[model samples]
Target: MNEIISGEKILVTGGAGFIGSNLCEVLLDSNNTVVCLDNFATGKQENIAPFLKHPKFSFIQGDIRNLEDCLLATKNVDYVLHQAALGSVPRSIKNPITTNEVNISGFLNMLVASRDHHIKRFVYAASSSTYGDSQALPKVEENIGKPLSPYAVTKLVNELYADVFFKTYGLETIGLRYFNVFGKRQDPNGAYAAVIPKFVKQFMQLESPIINGDGTFSRDFTYIDNVVQANLKSLVASSTSVNNVYNIAFGDRNTLNDLVVYLKEYLAIYKPSIEKVPVIYGSERVGDIPHSHASIQKAKKYLNYQPEFSLQKGLQEAVDWYWKNL
Candidate 1:
């Protein structure tokens, strides 16, 4: 396994968002100088607030959509972890044009800037949505079905772009196809908020959380720390690991009902009344698959990636954080 010990100056685009901020925090703690580029569109200011005065950490208030900003951010950087994108399937369904402009076009801008600047490696955030309509039990890297939504299309295009960048410009790249990641600092108030944090918030407030479908739908819910490990490993992995996408997950699946049980169990510790909180059922979301599981074997064999947090372990940590923070 490769570890980022110190001394590398890395640029993390979208470093104000949940995942990006976590990456920034870890890098800084490892004594690596970090430049965070974010427009605060979907990213929160509070997420990056603590790093404001750190000597080794710098913030660039910019959008990836602009080639100039991407060029500026990648300058003199050893590596680029590109996490800037408009996420959420429903958000893409509602405003695909903006999603395309940000996720696809913005991704291209970052690629060009990284290539031009001669960055050592570019590790980017790919999505499990790229699996699309495939019915595979544990989604492998090569077997992908057609994209089901604009968000999925954008992520798939990112893989294509990264592949071309590596082949055409010799810009080494690794894409991490993240599963349904959840953990601390994840916003739970938005319309497109992730199920885990959203439910935690609802339960904290003694409000009923709505579960789409009959609660049989399942997903490979990865923890943020696991994702952070994957990103750091991608940064330092050998040449053989570059130019390929790996599924970053815990290699397990759980239904919505299962998730609810865990949430209620964890939160009931904070407030015993939360145990009786009712869950409402609603229609299944469009662009949603019935089940999602990941094959992390490739990641382990190639990058020596080993995830430490299971869904239950991560949920306990998340519930604790939300209990104190929210």
Candidate 2:
């Protein structure tokens, strides 16, 4: 197994966002110098507020769409956790041009900068949506289907670009196909808010949480900490594991109904009435997969990514957080 990388300068591109900020916090805790670059379009100021005072933490207000900003952020950076991209399938469907600009062109810019700066490794956030329209129960890294959405297309392009960079330019790149990641600091007010945080917020305010489907659609709902661990492991993974992608997930499946039941069970501790809050079902979303469960065997074999939090454990943690913080 590879040891966790620490005590070096690292760049987290979306360090003000939920997953990136958590990575920033963990990197800082591990005695690393963290340079955060975020444009604050979707990333929040409060997400990184605590680290503003830290001596090793630095923030740069910049966009990945600009090559100059990418160049600036990668300077003197040992590793790059490239998380800055316009996320959401709906958002991409609504505005594919901008999504392409940020996720594809911007990703290329980051790759160019990383290569130019001679960075050791480039690890980025890939998506399960790349497994588009496939009937595969457990998604594998090598066996990907066609992209179902514009967002999925962008992610697929990112992987292709990464592979080219590694094979052609010799820039070590690792892609993490993140499942439905949810935890503290994930935005709950936006139209593109992730389901877990959005549901938690709605239930907290006594509003009915809406499920997009009949609650039977299942997902490999991964926790933020598991993702954080995957990122850390990617940083220190051996050279053989450098230029491949891994499924960063808990390797378990849960339905929307199961999620709601767990949420009610956990949130009931703070507000007993939340348990009585009815769930409203609506039409299933477009470009939404019926089921998404990852085979984390590849990740375990290569990155040694052992996810510490199960769905219930992580949901309880997230609920406790929202109850106190939301």
Q: Once superposed on the true structure, which residue ranges of model 2 sit more than 4 Å away at CA?
A: none
- Residue range 212-307, candidate 2, lDDT tens digits: 989999999999999999999998888999888888889999999999999998988988999999999999998999999999999998898999
Candidate 1 lDDT trough over 10 residues, lowest sum = 1-10
Please write out the lDDT profile of model 1 over residues 1-326, one tens digit for every residue.
24864799999999999999999999999999999999999899999999999999999999999999999999999999999999999999999999999999999999999999999999999999999999988999999999999999999999999999999999999999999999999999888899999999899999999999999999999999999999998888889999999999999999999999999999999799999999999999999989999999999998889999999999999999998899
Candidate 1 error regions (>4 Å): none
lDDT of 1 at 299: 98
Model 2 pairs whose backbones collide: none
Pairs of residues clashing in candidate 1: none
lDDT of 1: 0.95
TM-scores for all candidates: the values are 0.99, 0.99
Q: In lDDT terms, which candidate is top?
A: 1
